[model samples]
Target chain A: MKRLLLFVPSLLLAAFAFGQKAYLEDPDNFDPTQPTKILVDIKQCDCQRLLGAPEVFLWTWEPAELPASDPNNNGSWTSSNPALAMTNEGDDVWSFTFTPTDFYGVGADAVYSTGFSFLVKAKDGSGLGGGGCDEDKTENLSIKPELPEVPVLVVAGFPSNLLPQDVFTLVYDNSQEEKVSMQNLSADEVYCYASAFVDSVEYEVTPFFQVPNNAALQMQSSGDGTFTLMFIPEQFFTNVPTGSTITSMRFVVRKKVYLGTADQVDDPLLVPVGCP
Target chain B: MKITLKYFFILLMAAPLFTACVEDDTPDIGEEGSKLDGINATWRLVEVNQQDDVSFTLETRNISDFLLADGNAPQITFNSADKTYSVDAKGKLNFWGTEGSWTFDDDVAPTNITLSPTGESDILVNLTATIRPVDKFLQIEFSRDCGGTSIITYLYKYERAN
Candidate 1:
């Protein structure tokens, strides 16, 4: 009996050393006294036996004592936000990219620590299964244990502008992560951006900052009271004009609304001039 | 000693429970719900009998010589003032109004359609049709014996194009 107790400590020590980092932390270790923002990559781990697509439910909690923690775990953590969790195409892998809502020191004056753990559930409630279609029940059905540490950080500044267009593109050392796309551009707004996606499937919506045309523009109304976007191309163009400055041949000149979902065009309007 | 033996026996019995945890977690596959019912809307005749068959009368000469056309040039415009026009859900192209007495037998193969005129049967055509959203063209034929025993067929095709 004494030897068994002696072996338990060594077994625990070995387990702790080999275990993966299962908590959230600010990777940059920013000050928690100010508003801190960190982008988390909640990726799918390969530990699941079935084709498991991981969906996360995030919360802030006080860490419970080990072994005494609730087993059929009810909500112990305070919920923050919910978002659509997507998966990597080739595998059963999925990920959630999110930042905490009140990263700024909204609740306190001093640095504090709290537990943030995501309760992950399989998209299909049937947990990972054994090999083959014939098996009824084989393996012990228990939550596969994994944990991620949540690090608190101090926020440095308010957004210089609260406009929805303000965005930060994180270019990492290798730049392997997916780039988010900017969306819903309006008329007369100009933007410039250079970006590439981590995966080809996500390339369609990669976001970026807008660059406006150099020449200031104004709306010039026609006799029919329909206005056209007018720009003095001479000031903006450094190269010879290959295309007409007057948008007569292009979509901007006609101001056509192609219909589908507002995002895509199914059948374009074909009204003749002054038809409407 | 007796208690330890019982615990060992329990663990041994439970070993089978933990041996192969494979459960068929596959989701149930069901047939996709019935293909959305084909919509009934005004369709124009594209060809009276066969496409590009000029033997079909009322074929226009202005179009491509190979293309067969219609004579009446009938265009179905929704009477914007009519209360039924606003209630159409199939979009302006394929929808009908509230008070629509429309029924279609698209469930049967090679569906047949009939139009029942509202209030006045001869002057205006109100339809309950089995037309698919595809096949935007409809042909209506009327045969009459004219000029002393000569049977003349009036063939007209309406094509759907805005």
Candidate 2:
């Protein structure tokens, strides 16, 4: 009887510790200082009581230094606070979106060093029995956030990320042009051939040379070999069918009179669209 | 009796002069014709420039042809008589509404105009107007701020349609 009791608890602890996993939704563009959604999969965990629970909460203590809005409040193991509740993302997956620096009440340095340590649990923790995995809760989970690298400024999008409805601005630094034929091009000579991909269907605007409108494809000059094109994706690409979702955009800057491939500033650049 | 009669005659003559010297308190209606006359005609959008407030970067584009290609060139008519303005943007531009009331900050040498969209009196948009006496071109500039810092400025250039 004693051996069976010990084995049962050991199996429960092992299931709780190894079955749960956490990851960021948008890992490619994850920035520790920005708001990001962390998803926790508890389908494989032994937390039966939490799988169908109406509400789940996040319990974190990684940074050691807690924010003023910390839901733990030193230690509230028995009471699940509403502020710590995790959003249910269906199929036994829970999500919590927060800016690490803001949520932890710490600086970027602290977040980079400590990362995040958390676990998903039910609101009623009375069944936990003082730190023991006796109830519906995952074992301690940790995430080491990686920051994205800063670009050197060949082209940059204002606001970094964009949605279809946003007033998007694509800035081109002419000084960084590598092609010999594209160098020292005047503002009036520079134009962009742009296209928006909606539902995998490409919808291109008028070509630079064949533009029916006068200088419609020409980029605006800001002096010092810098140019910009600003427009709302949905408004600028009028041919896009109604109610279609824009997935991404592609464009290439070239001379107004395309003599050859050498007239192009660079290869076509692709920009991914993000959800609002 | 002869000396008193002479003094009273002198006083009566000076009273008329004093009354004539008094300045008229009524406002000047600009006898040379109101400044609003220059902007009263219907104007169509010709060009638009978006300038960054921080870097002073500019993006200028001729939008008149694009507007025409879309079959709707955005136009606005300013009625000086009723102090009202109407816009026919055809959903191309979002700066102005269908109709609104307008007023110049200084009626004599006005540099700025305030527009109040219909049914939205609390929301006001102030635009700097550049209108020359002989030029048919009109330029209105406005700034958009984010987090209490001016970020971008929109300059709309228009030409007299009528």
Best by TM-score: 2
lDDT of 1 at B74: 31
Which ten contiguous residues of candidate 1 chain A have the minimum total lDDT? A154-163
Per-residue lDDT of candidate 1, residues A163-228 (tens digit):
111111111111111211212223432212212122221121112211122222222222332223
How well does candidate 1 match the true structure in TM-score terms? 0.17
**Model 2 interface RMSD over true interface Cα atoms:** 10.4
C-alpha positional error of residue A249 in candidate 2 after TM-score superposition, expressed in Å: 5.7
Q: What share of the true interface contacts does candidate 1 keep?
A: 0.00
User: lDDT by residue for model 2 over A1-31, one digit each (tens)?
Assistant: 9999999999998786546588777778877
TM-score of each: 0.17, 0.38
lDDT of 2 by residue, B26-80 (tens): 8965545456787788988877655544341232334344345565668889888
Model 2, residue B108: distance off in Å is 3.5
Candidate 2 regions off by >4 Å?
A1-231, A237-276, B1-32, B56-72, B119-135
